[model samples]
Target: MARHPVRAKDFAVGEEPATVVVGLIASPGPAAEMAEALVGGLARQMGERLPGARWSVRVVADRLVGGPAPLHELVARTRRRLLDGGWQLAVFLTDLPLQTARRPVVAHASSAHGVAVLSLPALGAVGVERRADEAIVRLVAVLVGGGDAPVDVKPSGDDGGGKHRDALLRRLRELGTVAGDDRGAGLVTGVITGNLRLLIGMLRANRPWRLAVELSRALVAAVAAGVFALVTNDIWLLADNLGWLRQTLVGAGSVLAVVLTLLLGADLWERAPPQRDPEVVRATREQVVLLNAVTVTTLVIGVLALYCALFVLSLVSVLLLVPPGLHAAALDHPTGFSDQVELAWLVSALATLGGALGAGLESDETVREAAYAYQPDRSLTG
Candidate 1:
């Protein structure tokens, strides 16, 4: 006699596989983008890999974390959302970098609550999407299978067995360490690589190019200054005389000046919060330092992008408006393409200095909104 292949529900005759609904609550911006991009595929993958149940996913964009909050409290809040929405499992994806015991946290999962919180920055600045996909699958499996289940969930494409599995595990470990307690079952806490990974991740999240775009007044001032320098004979002479070393120095100095002006004028620097507890105070100080570093780096990148734009604009103006013969006559020497480039270089530097003055026109709120480090209620004591 021939036998039929048994289905999972066969043991409990006439039973259907349970449907498990998963909620992906993502913070606005990158977190939302990631969640939206992965939701459909993630749901399908979960259904295929975990055969006992059918999986469905929903994405919600809302800011869940802004200031310091206890891990248990965050879990509780997420659990409430899950229960309220009738979700069997919930994952909170945040762009903000999280830390516990001075170590960066990548993901924290609570089997009891059926919720997990992932700090995107702790995944590093590269390959974040793939890493996040793997994490979500593994976390979902762990949550659904109870705390005793294996944390590793190999991708369906993996055929190398232990080697591929080991490689994946190693990469995940590099992202963070697994730390947990009674409050949470699976807690992964460790820096991506070191402090540099956090800095790079923060920079990526800041999107400094947007900062350059927002400084409209400064850009106008820079263009005006570049135009004036292009028309002046004295600037032509100075560009002819100044060596490449001096030109580089001038450019670096101008960028530094703009960075400083923005930092001071806009008051972008952060000060550590006052707290009675020594640990809280220390943690806040570290956070302040990281925020300041991110702020300064953000300004530098923005100013440098502005400078590059000015240089390109000046170069085109010099090429179109001033003839090579006229430039050579003004410099009292034979000139070529290099002379035009040098002129543009110097003009951009001078224009950047003018931009520093124009930066004052931008309100503090405008600049702060463009930066990722701006958290209105960021207090460790809270």
Candidate 2:
């Protein structure tokens, strides 16, 4: 018989052994909750993805380094507790409170020596090491390296008891937008408003984890778009004064929404813990569509108002060019005061129209949906 005898599985099959152990290290004090949450999240995540592995949380009370992880302390602890159970690896997650949004998670994997170590920042677990929504998704993907088949992030059309609604309810509570019962109707309104904000964010955001990033990003983008519309409307406004670099940046910002949306779909929203209400899903989509429409309308109106203003300003400028002595009869007056006044009034009217149109476009559709989607389940989220 061909020696099928000493197989790798056979060598370890009968051996009594504790399962692979994972070690978690974090700080103490007020950050204890954050540390515990990280450990809990990691354990849960690993349980779902790596069921074969066993894990434990170790809180290192080394306050010498403040809230950030102490690398040496973590490495020392790993050898003490985790290595006993035939542990395969140890991941030390920490928060870098001094850094910006760039490169949050740091992993140090080492498997050849019968042990692997990954030291990564929890990202936004603390206030300072906060990253964007997309960044969080990307980090997760990196940590949970993809080998298995790609799972679709989009919600299946199957009416699974409004899982989406349940998800939203969870988010609302997290955002403190609603409270009380898990299935309370008082939060229905919050769900609508929260969901609308989510749609705008998802459609215009590059990160899924940003389901909770708030309106700061949107406001910033809106301001950039408004500026771009003005500068692009008049080539000289940007090209002549701001130069090519500034013009390019402005143009890029105006067109980056699609890219943001794509990133959010892949790296952000789908992977994030259940957020946004399911019932509000439709409303969120509608709100996003309306925002696009309103954005266009406002841009057009703004351009028209600007044109009128420029025209009137041109007349005033022409008047400045003419000498007082050159002005004779109203017909021959060099300053063109009569024409300038007429143009200014036209400009004012157009400005008023644009402002009114912009105001009118601000329907509750977007706001309601934004609230609904994000803050859907106030109980779970809270």
lDDT of 1 by residue, 47-72 (tens): 55554455789999978767656555
Candidate 2 Cα errors over 4 Å, as ranges? 1-18, 38-41, 54-60, 63-88, 97-107, 112-122, 125-382
Provide the lDDT at 228 for model 1.
86
Best by lDDT: 1
Candidate 2 lDDT, 1-382, residue by residue in tens: 1111112331246642123334443445434454554554554443333222233434443233444443333333433333332223334334343221223324332111111223233332445223322222222222222111221122323355234323322322222222222343434444445445333332232222222122233333333333333323232222234544554454344233322332232221211122266433333233223333323322333333333444454346435643434333233434345543443333333333333333333333321122122111111112
lDDT of each: 0.66, 0.32
Worst 10 residues of 1 by lDDT: 181-190
Candidate 1, residue 179: the lDDT equals: 18
Tell me, by TM-score, which candidate is best.
1
